[model samples]
Target: MSDHTIPHIGAAWREVVADLFEMTKPKVVLVMLITVWVGMALTPIGAIPWLAVIAGNIGIAALAGAGAAFNHILDEHIDQKMARTHKRPVATGRISRRAGLSFAGFLSVFGFSVLMIFTNALTAWLTLFSMVGYALVYTAYLKRATPQNIVIGGLAGAMPPLLGWTAITGHVMGLPLLLVLIIFAWTPPHFWALAIHRRDDYARAKIPMMPVTHGIAFTRIQVWLYSWLLLSVSMLPVALGALGGIYALSALLLGARFLQWSYWLLYEKKPDAPWGMFKYSISYLMILFIMMLVDHFTWSWLVSIIFPNI
Candidate 1:
């Protein structure tokens, strides 16, 4: 091919790759992958089966991406109206609705197939429920209908770790359920922080976010309430003897920081305060999960070193 043709072809290929990546909502998928990995690593019975774990991870990630894409599809009109979401692929018209929906369908089928074939039926079914919960119930209905959407819909987001636990053990138990509860409790404060910052955008889009409908003061109070609940929930592993004192200390410190930020967001009226709370909330959850995984592995290492017999 001529030099001019080569550059044209390369540009076209790059666009194609970009469009495909956009369909997967790559950043969100990355978060799902990390949490699932942490869940598998924190299991007490040594390393999980690699093949099943990897297969389940891929399926879960794909399903999450598909749901995000379908959300963009359903919310395209609203997204286009909101400054925060106006530049999304669907909203920008870079990807047609038909193409986006088709991609979503393909991803859902492939992901469900991987889960069923490589993992157990239970994992497969749970994953399917997660997809529907996010794509249909949360995105299509609850998001527009009520300010409590994320609270109800968070069950789907919180399922990844449980899915990972089940994929390894082929059953659910107290520990995995605790992990699920951690994410569930973490969800409201996390998203509410973002909604607090984006209240104007949500209001313009006519979505009934807590801050938009119930007013900022009410939403701020809810953020503080949820933050406290999350802190209590985070201590459960330590209380159950699943973790060591180190984990308890970490939880105390992290939860304190989380509450401090939420408290400021609740009481302060600074222009930058909402943004600060939003950033801190993400860090708060990420660090909490990281500390959990680290505490688990570190405690195990210490026991092995000190005992050297058991």
Candidate 2:
């Protein structure tokens, strides 16, 4: 081959390699990491250990990616039925099952080692369980067995924040559980919105998503109801004295907007679109976590400056 042809071939191979990496669903892993980071940030002013934070986030992200890869492998048949996922590397045969599972095993082992070495053993073990919960219990079983799949399976997805908190504190506590609860409440609406758009695909796959099992009307009502529940849960931080005015104000506004949009989704004769809500749900969670960080830092500073004697 000519020199120019060699370069072109190299670029093509690199693109294929990139496509393989996409199988791990890195963007979803990043969202999980963001929550973990925020959870670490929420530790009382002097409690955070930066080294553990870094190690824990990296390890958790790797395991989360491994779990996602397992999901891709297990859902391959159903994945092929959905237009959105039909081209996945595993589904398209660009990645073989043995290769995919091997990659997942490698990631899981490496992630576990890092967490055990750099963070506490508690964090390492909990994160390992989360990976199994998401990949085996949620993806392989609950997802196919129930229309309430996302609702029940969401526990695995909601665990990163708690893992993050424990990484820092080396123990479990109420605040971390509250964060888990907030994410748990947010999961159904976040996912069901997309499920609405893909109802036909799910029906064809026999996956029993909410829209497939309960019909769109019922699913929309559930979304609206869950949005309200999420809003109520968002305020618990303020009520419990865990967060401050900044988080309170931000949560109220974000949750209200979420509730309003969900109401429109429920009652509108023909709603504008549900995809935007799906997209916004991702943004909403990230922003909510940011507000928590902002609240903690700013409020802690304010309290110190305003009432030095206290």
Candidate 3:
């Protein structure tokens, strides 16, 4: 082959590999895995099946990543138009549509098989649902159809804790439901803050994000409203005795900070303000979940120390 053809083939191979890796949406999967692990750790049951947990988490992460990959495939056209997404493998012509789809399919199959073989059928089924929700319903329909898309699509994102909870217990309960509710409520504010910052990019892509379709002022109001709702939802675990005072205090403090940031976004019309809130929202969720995990272990250790007889 000529030198020019050699370079083209080498670049094609590199792009194919990168596209395959990107199918996993590794960063998002990492956070999801952490939250799921927290759920597994916090469950009142003793002696979780370590291998099962690991396998299940890997499967969940793969499913999430594959779903995101498929999203990129489906959204490549719009992605090409959006400044933030134009350089993605699919959008940039680094990977072909067929290649992206095949990689996504492979990951999805592998993930589902792992969950089915190593974990319960329910978890596998739920994971499949989440994959389809994100890849098909959310990406193909909700993303451009309506501003309320995230609200509806957030259910899939909120399922991780429950997936983890059920991975161990094989059933859902009030406590795990509370985790789901917290994430569900948190999603709008968490995403809208970013959407506000990326509104122009979204508009340029002809995507109807809330900030693009309904105006930034309206989106700001929704962000603040959802922030308050998330704060209230975060308190449920403590109220229901699923968590102790330490968790309660931490949740309250974090919730306050989250609300403060939302309030800042609501009032601050400057372009940069939403970006700050957007970044904080990511940190807020991760920290809040970490605090919950910490509080769980701390309270259990204190109880053991104080009440040795029990």
Off by over 4 Å in 1: 1-3
lDDT of 3 by residue, 251-308 (tens): 8998898888888888884557788887877788888889888889998889899998
State which candidate, 1 or 3, has the greater lDDT.
3
Highest-scoring model, lDDT? 2
Residue 164 alpha-carbon offset, candidate 1, angstroms: 0.9
Q: What is the lDDT of candidate 3?
A: 0.86
Report the number of clashing residue pairs per model.
0, 0, 1
**CA lDDT for candidate 2:** 0.89
| Model 2 CA deviation exceeding 4 Å by range | 1-9, 45-48, 307-310
**What TM-score do all the candidates reach, one by one?**
0.95, 0.95, 0.94
lDDT of 1 by residue, 1-310 (tens): 7879989999987986697678678877777777787777776566558888889898888888889889889999999998888888888988889989998998999999999899888888898898899999999999999999999989988888888877777788787788789889988888888888889899889999999999989988999999899989999989998888877898899899888888888888566777888787767767777887888888888989999999
Worst 10 residues of 2 by lDDT: 267-276
- What C-alpha lDDT, on a 0 to 100 scale, does residue 260 get in candidate 2? 76
Residue 161, candidate 1: C-alpha displacement in angstroms: 0.8
Clashes of 2: 0
